[model samples]
Every structure is written in C-alpha cells, then in structure tokens.
Target: MRRAAALLLVLTSALALAACDRQAGPASPGDRGRLPLAEYDMPEDDVRVVGTARWTLAKECMVRLGFDRLRDLDIDPLPGWPRRPAGTGVVSLVVYASDDFRYGVQDPEQAARYGYQAARVDYERHYREKKWTLPEYLALTGEFVGDDPKSVHGHLVPKRGCLGEADRAIHGTVPQDRKDPVLDLGAESLEQGKRDRAWKKADRAWSACMRRAGHRYATPTDAASDPDRDREELEENLTDPEYDLNQPSAAEKKTATADARCKRRTGYVRTVHAVDVRIQNKLIASNRAKLEDQRRWNRDAARRARDILADRS
Candidate 1:
C-alpha cells in the first residue's frame, strides 16, 4: 500500500486536481500485454467497479463514503508564507480509495491481483522515470507515501510520457533529496528544541512550496557573467538582514526559503515500474525477489556507465 501510495499520488493528484487530467493516455505498451479477465472466476458477491477512464463511484455506501465526480478541486497553497526553498513542488493532499480496479476485477483475490498488478506497472514506470534509488524511497515511506493508498500527495505519477520526466529543475533525484524547506525547517526546529518555532517555519515553507511549484533552487553560477559588477551588486542587494529565512512574510520577506530551494534547473526521466512480478497470483501481490532483481540490474548498469565516465577523466 505504501509503495502504491507513492506511485499513485502523482497520477491520482493530477486526476483529482488538474483542470485537465487528459482522459488517460493512448494505448500504453503494457495495455497490449494485459491478460484476459475470463481466465478467472472466483466470486459471486463482491464489490467492484471498473473503467477508470471515466470517473464513477462503485458504491456510495455511506455518508462521505459514497464518491462523486468533481469538475476539479482547488490546489492553490496558502499565501503570505515563506516561499519553498527553490524548486519545491506544489504540495497538496491527495486521496484515492477505489472499490474497484481500473482493469475491472472483483474476485477479492483476483481483484488484489489485477489491482496490484496495475499498481506494479505504474510503479515500474514511476521508478524508471524518476530514476529512484531504493534507499531514498525507503526514507519517504514514513511520511509522504504511507501504507495507505487513499492518503497521498497523488501527483507522483505522470499521465503520459515515453519515459518518466526527470525534473532537474528541483535538483534532488530522490524523493527526500528534493528541495523542501518545509521538512528542512522541521529538522531545524527539532535541533533548536523549539517545536513551536519549527512548526511555524514548516508551515511557512509548505505554503511557499505549494504556491511556487516547479521553481528551482539554483546555486551560484560563476558570478553571473558580469563577474565583478554582478557580484558587487548582489552583495549590496543582500547586505541587509532581509534574506534571513527565520523570519516569515512581513510584506517585506517574500518567501526567500522557496527561492533558495528552487534555484537550480535540470531534467531527467522518472521510472514507472519498480517492482517485477513473476506470476500474477491471487493472495500475494508483489514479488519482492523479482523486483529486487530488476532493481539490481538497473543499478549495476548505471554504476558501470558512471564508473567508465569517471575513469575516462
């Protein structure tokens, strides 16, 4: 569930909030390889819903339990907060709780199979696109993408792309490595023994992140071409204590943290499929062994190429 949540959030969030989620994608490679559903029949009474291309509820069972389609949801972040430390993505809540699989299966066991299978495909694509490192993923499991598919940020997955778009704009390749002054402030607070101060800083950072999505946190770029003049001007401009990140918005402080975070620009592909399943089963969902095999292959290949490049120099 935690794995799914991380992968699902990107796709789910776009579907949930984007003014236009682009009606799924044209036939994907995996779509052609899908197995027929007629192969299995295990349930007479089960709750299931299919056809995710269009939004519909499987069952509106209870208060707030029944789902309804919405044109879109509001996603703007709170204003007057410190900007996210450069290149921070817009932050928002994402929820996905479907009583059915997009591929149409409801046989509990089969449902789990079809459901998690689809998740694996998406997951693989996500990892491939993001070029995710396993360790970084493990770190974020506790907070951002927990064990619940229903509660996540949801925009982690892309709607359509040949390969996952690697955003060099934000710098950090791994989820946790990305620029996020919100979390950074939290750490600082813990260090300072000032929980209240930390929370306040975090809130400001989040607000900034949510608003200034897609910005980069760039570092010094060799004196900005003009060299001496640029450096002198920049020094003069920054001479004031106004750049201090500890201070929140005061009509003067315009989210410096966010600016700091999003100062760099680069791009890479994000992977979708991370797990490799050997056989499509009923009860057991993911095959850790297969997944690890694929991961090891990718890691080794990348390492060798990088080593070659280093050796050349």
Candidate 2:
C-alpha cells in the first residue's frame, strides 16, 4: 500500500504540474512500460521545470525579504517529491511515475541492484539535510498570524509569506484543492485494478513462482510490506553497530530479486497494468466533464506559471 501510495501521489500530482504548460514528450521506457492513463499524466521533466520555477520564485521573494538562509530549502520536501537533484544520476525523485513498478520490483535489473528500495532513500536523505526552524517555517507557511499583526525583521510578512506570494503569482487566487476528480479517479482505478480477475490470477501465479524460488509470500504486497522484516532488520543490525538502516539487507536483495523474477515469469506487471488501464478507461469515460474542468484549470495556471518563470529567466 505504501508503494502504491507513492506512485499514485505522483500520478495525481501530474495535475499539479499542469500549472505550467510543457507538452510531455515520448513516454519513458521501463518495466511496466506505458499505460493508457499516462496520456493524462505530466512528464517528469515538465514537473521538474514547473516545480523549480515555483521554488525559484519563492527563493527570490525570500532573498528580497532578507531571508537568504532559506534559499537552499526544497519547495516540497516530502517523500516522493518530484524533481531530480543535481548529481543524483538516473535516480528518479518522482519514483515510478513514468513507469509502473507500484506492483513491486518489476524490473529485473533494478531488483537485482537495489532490491525493494526506490528513490525515497536518496530523497529522504536530501530532505533531512535541512531542518526548518520556526522562523523559516513561519516564513514558508504564514499560518499563525492574523490579518494585521505579523512582522519579521521589522518588515510586514506578506500573507502566506514567500511561498504564498510565489503561489499567488503563479496560480493566482485559486485554491489548489485536494478533492480533484482526476485524483479521485486515479485512486479508484488502482483500487479497482487490484480486484480484477486477471490481477488476482497473476498474483497467484507470481506467488507460486515465488514459492518455487524459495520465498513464501502470497502477494507482492506481502513480500514488500512484511511488518516483521523491519523489526528483524533492526535486531540484526543492532549487533553490527555500524549498519546503515537505509541500505537494503542481503536477505532483502535476495527476496526482491526473486520477487522481480517471479513477477516477470508470471507476467504480473503486464497483467496488473492492463487491469489498471481497463479500470481507468472506464473511470475516465464516466468522468470526462470533471477531468476536463480540472485540465482547463491546470492549463490556465500553467500559462501563468510559464510566463512568470520566463520573465524571471
């Protein structure tokens, strides 16, 4: 579920990236290939550009307001935050947005190399590099103070501070609602995809293949999300005294490698992705009006954001 949540958030946030328009290019190649739903999702490069533009505007605002210390902070610093950092190589900060490894380690090479770990490892490290102080938090959010009595460094803090200023400049006064129909449909499609007969059959096949490979997980989720794994890892690492918990264990690598191989042998990725496509196509057909409205809002926001970024550049 956690893995799926990561991918789903990336998919839905594609709408958020639509705040700045740049038509996506060819779909990226990956284990799960490109699904039909990707036609509506923003490309990772566009998301990075738009996100960087937002971050740049906010940083400029902070510098102008004499808060240069906050310059290096990322705009969105949570897990699965999109936008690859400099020198991160092919590590995808957006996780498997372009691809579809939400079903687990679908790529044989990735599974053999990194096991179940994804970009979240590097992203979390980057996120932890900067801790937000109270002043920085206040400047970033502008939540506690009322309409008349908020001043920092003898200058009146604008409503929502630099972040709000940047947002308003790009997206105007429109509220970025979480209740988007497209996002709702995406969640629904994923949930429904799991219930599909083909999906279940593939899961069974994958499970049998895993058993043959000397693992006993009934589902990919079971293999990926075993609660005991973390506790056992902690116990094992406690004896070493120098273990990096972030690094995948030898056992994990072996298991994940097997999981990937089983998935490939059993056609799990293909089956589940097809199930999702069927489910999403139905949802999209039923919710065209709502989706269009969402897209229209995003297009307008994108135009504004693009112009603002261009001006700054």
* Deviation from native of the Cα of residue 24 in model 1, angstroms: 4.9
Number of backbone clashes in candidate 1: 54
Cα error, candidate 2, residue 262 (Å): 0.2
Q: lDDT per model, in order?
A: 0.25, 0.60
Which candidate number maximizes TM-score?
2
Model 1, span 234-274: residue lDDT tens: 56657676653222222211223222232211100001011
Worst 10 residues of 2 by lDDT: 1-10
Q: After superposition, how far is residue 162 of candidate 1 from its true place, in Å?
A: 17
RMSD of 1: 24.0
At residue 196, what lDDT does model 1 achieve?
39
lDDT assessment of candidate 2: 0.60
Model 2 lDDT at residue 237: 82
Provide the lDDT at 108 for model 2. 68
